[model samples]
Target: MDALTALHNRVSTGKLTEPAPTEQQRKNIFLAALRAADHACLRPWRFLLVEGEGRERLGGIFLKAAEQAEGAALTEAQRQRTKAMPLRAPLIIVAITRLQEHPKVPHLEQHMSTAGAVQAMLTAAYAEGIGAYWRTGPLAGNPLVAEGLGLANNERIAGFIYCGTPDKAPRQAPDLAVDEFFSYWGAH
Candidate 1:
């Protein structure tokens, strides 16, 4: 599909099924991510894929975060719920950003670059008939999650991209008027 059509049709696929993408397919996805718009070629993005039994380890990270956040107040049931998040999908891709020392490349720029990479990955998945969803829910920003992903103090987990075969065809997306959001010069 063309870029505009692919973008206009891309929708988050939260409900997925068994059989995650193969290693070769994942490589293709990563290649697409590398082509994302990054000013000065900083390449500040990194990704970690969790699949199969590896997903269990990721769930442990979420559980740990809940434990740390709630301390002794957290109930066992809540802990178990946290542990179930990664199991909801066939695969989870952790997006990370590393800070660079460029004088002109601020931290925000690096973050934008990472986000670009994430969108590129999602678009590539859409193009290849795979379902992908980027989530920055509570677990994604948990400090224990960063530790679990082995991120540096200066690095952070931007989000998790859950990917798998779609359980069903994508639903129609809602449309919004752009002019409602746009501002006119000297209108105020």
Candidate 2:
């Protein structure tokens, strides 16, 4: 698909199947992410590609986070479910952001840039006919999870990009009007 088409049609795929991008394809996806607009060239984004046994490791992080939060109240079944989340897709890309002290870029802008990286990755995956989804919850941002992932105190997981072949066709996008969310400033 062309860039414009991909931009308009890229929607989250919740039912991602197995067989995600190969190692080489993942490299290409990361390359696309690096090309996202970086204000002041802060380049504040980092990525952790979880696949194979790495996915299990990520799941363990989630389970550990749950355990730390709930302690004895955390059920064994819930812990198992946390570990199984990674298996839902063939791979998951953990998006991380590095805080900058003297950055000319604002924190919100840097966050948007990281989101733009996610967009780039999703677009690239769409171009390759791959299904992808961005997901996050309490576990993603938990300190225990961060520790399990070996991230610094200043780093955070923006979201997890689950990738695989389409388990089903994507839904058609709803018709949208620019006027609904757009505003003219100086002159229309």
Candidate 3:
């Protein structure tokens, strides 16, 4: 698909199935991510690719983290759901931001750069006929999850990007009005 078409039509695919993106598709996705704009060229982002047994292990880590956070209060259904979260897709990319003290760029901008990278990846996935979803919940911010994922103190989870085959055809992108979100501001 054309770049403009991909950018305008990309949408999150929540119902992903087996058969993850092909190696070439992944390359395109990652390359798009690497092109995200960054201040001072900090390159403050890193990613973890989880698939097959790694997804199971990630689910275990999530379960442990959730259990620690909620204790016995967690219902059986919740526990099972937590354990199966990672199984929703065939492959998962854990986006992380490495914080640094830059004279000009703050931590928030660094995180924004990572967000841009993930967005680019999502668009690229859409262009390649792959399903992709970016998700972040309580588990994403839990300290236990950070430790389990071997994230350092300066590294923070940005999102869990799930990629796979869509269960059905992708829905059309909503036609939003540019005027609704854009405006002219010269000397307001």
The lDDT values for all models are 0.86, 0.85, 0.95
Residue lDDT tens for model 1, 82-168: 888888789889999998889888999999999999998998888777888998977777888888888998898889999999989
lDDT of 3 by residue, 77-112 (tens): 998999999999999999999999999999999999
RMSD of 2: 1.6
Off by over 4 Å in 3: none
Judging by lDDT against the true structure, name the best candidate.
3
1-188: candidate 2 lDDT, tens digit per residue: 78899888888788987888877778778888999898889888999878899888878777778878887476778778877998889988999988776547788888888999998998888877788999988887899888888999778889999999989988877889989998888976
> What is the Å distance of residue 156 in model 2 from its true position?
1.2
Write out the backbone clash pairs for model 2: none
Better of 1 and 3 by TM-score: 3
Strongest candidate by TM-score: 3
TM-score of 1: 0.91
Question: Where is model 1 more than 4 Å wrong at Cα?
Answer: 183-188
